[model samples]
Target chain A: MTYDPVLLANIDKKDSHTLPVYQSGGGYRGLRRALEDMSPADVVELVKQSGLRGRGGAGFPTGAKWSFLPKNHPGPVYFCVNADESEPGTFVNRVQMELDPHQVLEGTIISCYATGASTAYIYLRHEYPLARRRMQAAVGECYAAGLLGENILGGGFSLDVHIHVGAGAYVCGEETGLIESIEGRRAWPRIKPPYPAVEGLFRKPTVVNNVETLACVKQIVDRGADWFRSMGTPPDPNDPRDPGSFGPKLFGLSGHVNRPGCYEAPLGITVRRLIDEYGGGVWKGRRAKAAIVGGLSTGLVTEAEFDTPLDFSAPIRAGCLGLGTGGVIVLDETYSMIDFLHNSCRFFAHESCGQCTPCREGTQWALEMLERIRAGRGRLRDLDLLREIGETIGIMPGTTICGLADGAAWPIKTALGKFREEFEGYVKEPTTV
Target chain B: MNVLDAETRENIDTIAGRYPTRRAAVLPVLHAVNDRLGYVPTEAVVELAELLELAPADVQDTLSFYGFFKQDKPQGEYRVWVCRSLSCAARGGEELLEYLCEKLKIRPGETTPDGRVTLEFAECLGACEAAPAVLVNDTLYGNMTREKIDELIRRVRAGTHHDATE
Candidate 1:
């Protein structure tokens, strides 16, 4: 019922090469209005009113992010779409860019116009060459339609979008790290305070929003803010002030679930509903033993909280888990949770970006502990040490230069906290059947 | 077809203009060449390096650094890339990849003798849902199994893959 017919959002996977097709489907109409009708400040105001947040992971308000640009700073501002989607379970942005490249371009253009940014960059991961090609073609389509370049839409406003493919690095998904990668440096995060909004991308004021966040701009402008606010969960009685904080999130369902794919559901949909209703339940009628709600890094929720709503705040408050990236990974009865944790810890360890001491050493220590435990070579104290290390590094959120430290630390801590019995069970039996 | 098409060549030139020095366009030029030729050959690498005013070794280094570029040989016309990261691996990707190699009658890194298909191992293709998934050339196939891969390869080889939309 959350699916709106008006906002079905066509995925032009076919014939993505033509401008006529995109234009026929009401493309460039958002950009057209932004250029001719809305002034820069006016556009920013509309976004602020819309209550849109960044769809990447950190749910920062999109308009507030745009408004973060210092007005007194007498220089050029930039918008870098964080298309560097190297998150483990998050691949929603790739489809958003690939299926509707023009939509993304339009949103980027509108954002650039609103932000008074003459230049915008889509920093994509290098593995996504197909997406890079499609984005480039979409940019070309925009230019051909006179929606970009000099005097766009006869508004005397010129904007340029450059697609920069990043070399493979998970750290680059972090906004500041992405800016560094775009600036032709190593893909490690910079310290905040000098956040990307204040001083980013060649040391100028820059706003980095996720690809999905940018893509949502067109819908907000075209349909108006009230329309978007209508779809998501009604404001909770608990939080009357920010009822519409989290909107419809695209859940990337993976693992042993049948019909596993990206399902655009409202924020408050339950894990059980997503499994039974949207995903057709577990594959081959297998019992769902564990479900990693927000990716491998997020806590593995067991049978206790299966009916927990899959929103940001609810899962955090109830089950101590946040919907980071909205990646729901269902594990069947046969899968080994310890092995999976071991594998995930290895990934975090490998991609730590080596910036801070806690993250660099803590991630390595976690993986090593997981490896030893998985290999049936660990003492009970080692299990305690795993919990200790995870907790010690968990205190440093946004403490390191980038979020990788937090990314590596938080999941381990949460998993240890939630699944201590499972870890302990692994110690005694080695194989829990 | 050795040279890029007119439009593609122009696009490559535009990437070249982005860098202050031409030598910096090596990676971008390699992408253009790969997009055109399906894989970067020795001749294309030499030509690109020469065009970018760098040693061939520089281009080779970049190709090796990234899993996308193939330097030793050309992948077949149909390149099936399976993601081999943690999520996919946990979701039975190893078995699926093994099944693909057997069905294709080539190793994971080898192209079929007929030049019709090539199997390459990718790390986290961003399509975790498709877990045990493969990208046959540009099209993404997800929720895959050995039987599914077998049927797909058969249809592709027989030229009956009418649904091949990249």
Candidate 2:
């Protein structure tokens, strides 16, 4: 695993946040190369060839997303960088922003060029004041260095980058919700068919990407596509259509692990290795019981399932959601699954935007049911009710405006499905009320 | 009477200039007010609406959606937020919060009688890598322990806790 580091190479360097230090370490070289040597179409083609996917939860292909934009659109195109890293177990984006703000800026400039966007916005989470300060400083540096503003780097490409801090909403991580938030409205997700590429952020063609995804773009431009694709194992070995997951991915390891920091590895690294080798095994010399591969929105897997590869498709094949934000939460034998689901449900209920009927109503009901069970007043049929509610909210397509409801429902269904016995143990026979 | 002071109004105007539309600066303007004034008063919302060219109701609607902005009254000098999410909870985050509440003689989301410290539970500060994290004001303290809490309270009371902004 002696692979060369790309995104995190300069993360630990002294004064890494400073523009001079970043430039000395070869920062903004991608922007330089893109602006001077490559065409906007060439940059997009390189990204497509590199097999880079969104580092945010969804795992959508980055280049393909850019390709969806209608070429030669009349109005101004926009680029919204999703720095609102609010996923419960994820902190990698915050680290990237804090340590190497210039890397994110470089990647963003490249993305704006590739997408034909003249204006860019970084939707940062409000809780991260340190990250915000660093980003503000870095953007100022870029503007002073002539890397931003009109005619950047003496090239005809011009882009304006602004930092828009989100007040406190998890749904804003959703692209359309982020666009709405940027528009000075509540972060309610818009329906697809008019995706961001078609109409976003003031009804103009927009490309919204996550922080880590944009950072990877800088590396993809610096190194050739084949060089970038050489690291990670793909989904299908034989078929190029699958593009198998490639490049380095940052895994946010936390909870009960001895070392709970963000670790970078190839996309298809095994979960067992990540937990034992990189995480330094479970804390207090305890054995790991279950693990949440991605964020809280994803399902839990038992210790036996630890062998599953950490990729977008591998975890889903193992009956969980894809590699979402790469936020791996480990639960030891001492932890209670019941309490875990309760906390997760509470977050969903509080954060749901109340846009759609099912998500608004379903999340609250699920939380109520979980609370009742935790209080030892749970009926035997309540488990069945929980299952039905989760399935109805998540299993059905077009049930809600965004995937928040589905994110709310998946953990409930998966937690109950795997830990039914633990849930059953908490159930009390109904006493006549 | 204007809820926002001259400096806050000027700061809000500057932020509004960053955006193409004045309405897009609502959150940043509110944040600036909260940073300076401690809480967003109803009068401030009315004034902000005039600044951003929106209705008072529109400002209030956006303000109500987010829990970060406190509208009722000024917060304590030190706002202590204990992370109670799963990762932090696993590593004594809840116990730490309970301990603080017992020592401070206040429940979560309540300020002490002295108005020096307000205790609250945060979902996740994105610092789970250092479990049982606590955020006082904007700066986050990680791997927090009982002794650390005691020291923090002492510093806040002594008016010696290092302010991130300063």
Candidate 3:
């Protein structure tokens, strides 16, 4: 590898999760720099200059998101770390939290400082008990070391951080849904006019960022924006607002691979290179048929589009929503497309928050159609009906309260369109359901 | 009768104080009771409602929204969640579940006759690199196999699930 890994550097070290080991490698230097040298506005501007984007599926610019908070909000502001990584085929956040928790904690403190947030909460998934234990230990260490409570390192900024473990609800991974869960309510996502930045987390200004996104915040403070921008795809010169993917990303590899694990690589590596080079090619020397490159929601990638760069913008051109989380699940020749689609659709169907009719009913209906097709009982129009449900259910179609519908829709719609022949083969008999 | 004792009440109070609103303590309180008793009983729900200053129906409403909390009865001491998501599924996760079910002689959501372990299928344990991962309560066991399952079960039966993870 040409470039050195920043985020995952400490993961392999023994006791790397401890505060001493983390500090020995200059861990809190990023927070120290932010608190000692930079003002809140300057810290936010530096992050904006770094061009860091959210790594939790959505590729939104992080610094611009922090700037959305009301400059003079009378009440205390809140920051939420979205550690609810329930996305299938994605587990890098879990690895980060469990192995090198201080980085996450340091990043959280810096994020709170930059956003003027007095309190922060990491909404960790209930399934991640090890991560919770490690993070709890790390948070305790920080408070004891004068890096968390009241005046931090003689800097006047005071911040309180808490870890709120979530029950098993996939919808809580959504930003608004996450806010709802934090408020101790159902994980149903709320409408976005009074966005979380404006009215969120107990009706105060809130900024919800992903784990990887915050790690980038610490790195940006440690190394200048130019150093961070040396790697990754540069922003579009013609398109003014496009903040291109910069810095190293944790692209996780699993399914039909010889060595299944998370590896740090630049953002623009092609899906084929990711699987063959990093993942040690497909196991059993099998040929790759298709892949869900970015979790289940980003849709499937067929052989023809495998060479598409796994950057923020390029995934859409390959028929996915974007490079969501960069979690690649490759399907080899033996794996059935129908079974894979059914499983992916079933995940969304089971996990919908039931707040909207389109997602609640459409996801279930889509699953039924897939089941029928898998059982050799599908009609040709059923495929068209599935496509219709996909088009009508998600945020892209303007029919739901949140993007969960959009996530559910992308793969079902994309798979039906891209793998038309395979789907058509199952629907040979024109039988009514 | 209030099922929550003084210790549970104290824990709930401290948790409620952590958040600005008493309502925000609902999950923490519920999780605490659920983990301790191995299930959130209906009686405990009403008791927790009073503690958190929430209505009984509101508590039940929120509790019902999540899949993790079991209200009917207490599960076994160990809750084994086997991953069956796409990444795990592609690598024999379904078969692994079936194998565990057959060996335990109990289906998903059912505890063993001795009430030692409760079996369930999980979406994804997020340890996908380990492919077919099995989560026993808080600890995740990766790269599962029949031998590992046998050792884990033996350890669980002996009341030492954390010992000899290999």
Task: Compare the candidates by lDDT and give the number of the best one.
Answer: 3
Tens-place lDDT per residue, model 1, A300-324, is 6775678888766666665443667
User: Candidate 2 has which clashing residue pairs, if any?
Assistant: A234-A244, A235-A244
Candidate 2 residue lDDT tens string, A261-332:
988998888888999989999989999988888887887788889999888888877778678888899999
- Top TM-score prediction, candidate number: 3
Chain B TM-score of candidate 1 stands at 0.83
Off by over 4 Å in 3: A237-241, A429-433, B163-166
Ranking by DockQ: 2, 3, 1
Model 2 segments beyond 4 Å from truth?
A237-241, A428-433
Model 1 regions lying over 4 Å from their true place:
A5-8, A12-18, A72-74, A233-246, A319-321, A394-399, B1-13, B19-80, B97-121, B136-139, B147-166
Please give, for residues B18-94, the per-residue lDDT of candidate 1 as tens digits: 54456546656766778677778887777676666778786676555455677677777777888766568877887
Q: Tens digits of per-residue lDDT for model 3 on A1-433?
A: 5667889999889899999999999999989989999999998999888889899998898999999999788869989999999999999999999899999889889999999999899999999988898999999999999999899999999988898989999999999999888888998899988999999999999999999998888888999899888889987787776679888899888998888899899889999898888899989999888888788898988877889898898888888988998889988987777888899889999999999998999999999988988888888998889989988998878999999888888898788888888888768953333
Which of 1 and 3 is the better model by TM-score?
3
DockQ of all candidate complexes: 0.28, 0.70, 0.69
